[model samples]
Target chain A: MVKGLLDWIDERFKIRDLWNDFADRPIPGGSSWFYVLGASLIFIFSLQMVTGILLAMYYAPTPDHAYASVKFIEEVAPFGSFVRGLHHWGASFMMVLVGLHMVRVFVFGAYKKPREIIWVLGVGLIAIVGGFAFTGYLLPWDQKAYWATVVGTNVAGTVPVVGGVLLRIVRGGTELGAFSLSRFFAIHTYILPWSLALLAGLHVFLLERAGAGGIWNAADRVPYKAEPLFPNQLFKDTVFIGMVFIALASMAVLFPAPLEPQADPTDSTYNPRPEWYFYFVFQMLKIFEGKLELLGTVILPNLGVAALLLIPFIDRSPERDPAKRKLMMAAGALFVATVIGLTIAGARAPIVNAPAVTSPSVLAGRAIYARNGCSACHGIFGKGGKIGPELTHVAARRPDAAWHLKHFRNPQAIVPGSIMPKLDLSDRELQELTDYMLSLK
Target chain B: MSDQDVSRRNFMIRTIIGIGAFIGAAISVPLAGFGILPVLRKKEPDWTDAGTAGDLMTDEPQERRFFQTVKNGWQEERVERTVWLVKKADGGITAFSPNCPHLGCGYRWFSQERQFKCPCHASLFAIDGKVISGPAPRALDTLSAKIESGKVLVKFEIFQVGTTKKAAA
Candidate 1:
């Protein structure tokens, strides 16, 4: 049996040669913390696949009882919570690492010239990974994913020209409905993986062919010796991996992800935000709202990336020494400054969920909630079961009664395509519900 | 001019044109590949079992997680997956992903609304993943699911998440 298995394996993948090639090569820059982010992404992806598979074993993708099933994964499946934890934290880390890798390449001018194709591939990878984060974000079907998807897609549809068509394709129809999950899941697990793997293989292949190139090496003229990728760099790689794992594990342990309320489509105050890496971009777009949505979201960033991609071709100073690359240094500094500014803007954006915490008007809100039979589809103050996002945080999150009133009266008016129906309410009823809702918090 | 001078000039021109064509072809392949990959990988609409029909209960969603070991390309190993077996109030059955369509957030069926709503943004859908309201782009995706032996199974392909089928804009 052992001999037969060995023969079968050899006849099939013939992976020995691939492994040998990897073993033989010495990577540019050998083993360094800087080089670890890309590899960490691969590690996280693998970890995500495994954990996702495990979670899926017990997960139900149906909007009905979706959260209940996830709760089962947390409570029943063997190491199910742990597995979900791994997948969750791993995803967050991958986004961070991917972002860092981009910045590293930018600063090092690794995308310059002969490596332009790689840079293009890198950009494509980043976008795909963001999609990965987005799709994966909804896998839990909790409050955050539900509200975020709605807000996120609304923003997506604002894109010009083919935006509507693109929106339809993504939702698998007109709204974020059934086909959307199917489409995203298929994309996430099937399409995205294959694309990423192909890109990853190609990226590494080119890396091997061209080696790592940058201004640091130009002064050396002579290609310096690098440690064999096997033991030397591998050990360092292992150390970095260990550090990442510990950090991720700590996060997973300290705060297992919180499941927000079941989605209700009717509720306003769906304050959503992207993962941290996206926070800066999200923040940039927020600032651009009502002013330069197009330039901020589409044109400006694309131009920045374009410049980054063209760095290798431009600034072709004959010198390779880092000390001599003053213009290149200045350009890098400018880009970093820009990104930092956007991130700061994002971090400081008006807190959409703060004011509600200060006010309490549960009596008025509860009256309306009861009158509307919101309890039928939603659980409130831990009274109802899983049907929609618990309104426990509604007041805490959306404090302004007037804003909430405007949002509640006809959410679709304020938020186009909102699932919430416009409630026919007198000003008194609105204020009463708002007060009651506020009191619950 | 001598033969050497003429030959050298022709050689350089040809080399440049050859390089340009190669670059153009290289770019085109990836662009075309991106467009065609979806069509190429679409699954044939065929019946695949999700699990033992007996395991599914009536009027409530039963979470079924299943796995299979198959050989595809170079890898062969057991892969796990999940789906919900929703027995409708009228005893009808459907299997769907908990993932909501509104921005890919997971959604739960609200027995109260007799609809599905996203907890993240309040997007509502009917029992079957239809967009009942709130920022949803489409309805729930239905899996080609059924029951076979006393076992749960899915037409499983362990694909990488976070790639493919991009959102608009």
Candidate 2:
């Protein structure tokens, strides 16, 4: 009966031809694991769309109920946690697969003359995927989401003349509130998803038109034999997708996505940190301070992205072999290393959470210390730099308050060879800092 | 084809485009308005009764939970909300928002510590809602409160967090 229905539909729509065109296409250089990244990305993207829709059924985008709605989806709805987990992990997987796919394309020089447009489309799709990560982040209305988005929108506010306008547009208002949450929801669920789908469809259509670039190392070789995509590329793609599914499922079952406390814009001690994927840029911002912040925040990042997008045009040479493309290969390697290095640095960066203390004076003193950049040179609780002696045990060594006060006033006078500069501060600040240092014991 | 026939065809095409554009505008204008108008309109303040002013103690903060009908978009529903009511030594009542000024984490009044401490960030506030210590950019947010017929009516408002100036959110 099902076969008869399919036949009946095929008679009107020519469904068999469509299946033949999709499944039995000739693939030059045949299938390899290197080619599976794109397939895996598409699979995960579809999974995300499905799971995302399910979660959206219960998610209220307003500030008043966003947190409650997410909680309902996670705890009350049947298989809600599972759906959320798949969606969560699916995002990360998409990011990873996109990166791998880009690398594969770059290594193979797949973005040659005929495929330049395809590469540009891929770059655009990457931006959309990033948009998904950013805007989707704020939907939960949790502390991490709120603060990270605050920092994210603030970064947009650093653009020279149009910065304020861009900030307002991105945030939907001056402050991150009901409108901001709703706007992010609209962008994440509606705008980005649809844009990605459209661009991704064009990208695949163009890829099919250009055909596979085939064996990077063997691009110069003559008359390449073609094999049918059915049971070959499809089989490999299925196996890899299955493996990814298992891995994502295991991760979901073992370590489900965490829900932090609901967003509180008033929590001053909470430091806004972006996701792991954004760690490289986050750490780069720390390196570029004050006057040079725009270099890290906008100029350099945009330049890098521009260069990535224009790779096919920039490297017009037709060479596809890695050995022949020495400059490009070296640059790619350096970029990867830098990203890994910065990510590690960001991971190890000191968490600036305020210590739990009841004393008002001590709290005041700690704030003063933080404001003065004492952490730059002096180590505290084994964190921070080691240029100066560790401040953790300073009170135990120097029990005199007057001595500490004198040291703050004139470091050189208190310790003749002391390299610590005498910080220009008022008497009240010195006293409070002294009291705080003593309380550290 | 005759000139008369061409003119007739042109009229048909133009009319088709005109009607198509009219239909497009008809659907899109309302859709855009539906999506954006609510976000732009100023939200009206709603006051909810907390409790009797006579039941509060001096120098102590009490948690008050009340259900207020919140009309968000098309949905009108009663949602549970909270406010910390502190009876001052001067026989006056001050209502404080539960959110910490640091990053918006809910804070609890610690009687033992004699301060309101946020669990997420440890921002401390004195009984008077002054910033005692930690990373709070400003003091605790105070809601507008008044006594009417021995009952306390509080108008809860969210302020922009992590800022020195208190701007309505």
Candidate 3:
């Protein structure tokens, strides 16, 4: 019965012939376990798609419900944690596998000749995968996601003339809020996925057309033998995929993804850091400041990508051996080293200090300050106006709390020609303001 | 092959299939149930104590801010909520939800104007929670309030904004 049904379908679809052709395809010389990275990445991506769909079944994209829905998936839904964990870890694995695959192709000189377009497609796939990660990172609507996105979008806002427009487009507005969350959710779940699927299809087709680049070692040339990609290569691919599945499963069970506290835009104490993969770029922002910021954030990164895309055009050599390609090898090594160094530096950077405590008197004083528009001239913790000295460490400089009380009542009494207005405050208001100022230290 | 050997092989196959089906069902049933359970769960109404009744002045509206623990799905968070408390002439208390009837922005009591004003869109409401002027579609939402042992407690509920009728959200 099954044979008859398959025969009926095969007449139109050529299913059996296609399977036979795929199974019998010839793998060129030097195909080994090293070639499994690409296949493994495809498997992981399939897993991510499955698990991501399952998650979207219950996820709510609104600002009020996004965090709550994720919490439901984590703590309430059965096996929800497992599914979410797989998707989360699968993303990281996909990134690592893509990197490893790119490295393998570069070292083997696969990007040299006929496979240049495939290499370009591979780069596009990497970017789409990265876009996947970035968009998905904000869907949880937690503090880490919120602040990281705020910083990430702000990085795009530094792109010279088009910066502001790009920022608005990426965020859907000037600030990160409901619109931002919804936009990210839509991109993560819809737009990027479809684009990635299409590009991935083209990428695989191009790769199949060019065939595997094969191992490039000089010593293994004589003994190298071409083999059919059936039981031999297929067996190895299955083993690698199985091992990866086990590792992913173990990771899903062991270290589930953490859902942090809900996002609070008013709370400035939270320190935002990007995911580990983005640490290098985040670190670059620190090294390059002011007008030179564009060099690190935009120009350099674009130059690197452009160079990579134009590799085949620049290096027209027929040489496939890494030993002969001394310059390319050295350049690749330097780039890798720089990225690792920057990532390490970013990871080790000091955290911002927490905001001061909000005692009753301090709260009252803060209210009084807001009411009197004191922040109009004096800056607090690097925010507000900069016409006057920063009041972040003001109490430390002038420890005598009574002086601030007098200054608020009459500014010229403390400093002649202070150009500051005198305030009318009750004794309790004066004391509360003094408490708030003293606490700033 | 002998008949007994064939029977034993068939028995083994049957056992394996049974176990596989059981395991599959075991994982899937609960997953489907949990996934749909949140949609079916009803939101339980809760009242939180605002403050002592003595703190409110007669015929005067005072803004009281307090942290209320709100539960949605599996997340429970303490969010600060503000309400306008008014002590009526009959010694009764009426609590108004702070969210404006215009666009849900928090409205504040303007002592000089003696009216509630939304800073976002300039919506104005009378001290008695009536719409006075501006873009407000209706009066301020009045929350369910009760006093026990001289303590004021209010049942806080969010209402749909930009509408003349008060509808719970």
Best by DockQ: 3
lDDT per residue for candidate 3 within A322-419, as digits (tens), equals 99999999988888889889999999989866455456787788788778888899877434676876686677677797899888889898989888
Interface RMSD to the true structure, each candidate: 18.3, 17.0, 6.7
Worst 10 residues of 2 chain A by lDDT: A352-361
Q: What is the TM-score of each candidate's chain B when compared with the real chain B?
A: 0.59, 0.78, 0.74
Q: Model 3, range B1-169, lDDT digits (tens) per residue?
A: 4998567545644654554455346445644665566665656558898878987888789999887898866557898888999998888889999899888999899888898889998878888899888899999999998888998999887889999899887
Candidate 2: tens digits of C-alpha lDDT, residues A83-129 = 67877878888888898899889988889889999999999999999
How high is the CA lDDT of each candidate model? 0.65, 0.81, 0.82
Better of 1 and 2 by TM-score: 2
Q: In model 3, which runs have C-alpha deviations exceeding 4 angstroms?
A: A217-220, A355-441, B1-169
lDDT of 1 by residue, A1-441 (tens): 998998799879888787777765765544455676777777677767656665655566667656777776665444445556767777778877887888777666677566777877887887778778887776667777776776566555557887667667666766656676667667777788788888877887887777666335634545664545655555555557666776876776677766777766655456676666667778776666543777766777778778765666675554445466777777777877877787777766775764442344444556667888877766653345456556755665666778878876788787777666677888778877777666544
Distance from true position, residue A406, model 3, in Å? Answer: 18
Evaluated on CA atoms against the true complex, candidate 2 attains a DockQ of 0.01
Q: Higher-TM-score candidate among 2 and 3? A: 3
Which prediction has more favorable lDDT, 2 or 3? 3
Q: Give the DockQ-based CAPRI class for model 1.
A: incorrect
Stretches > 4 Å off in candidate 2: A1-5, A217-224, A355-441, B1-169
Worst 10-residue lDDT window for candidate 3 chain B reads: B15-24
* Residue A6 in candidate 1, Cα distance off native in Å: 7.6
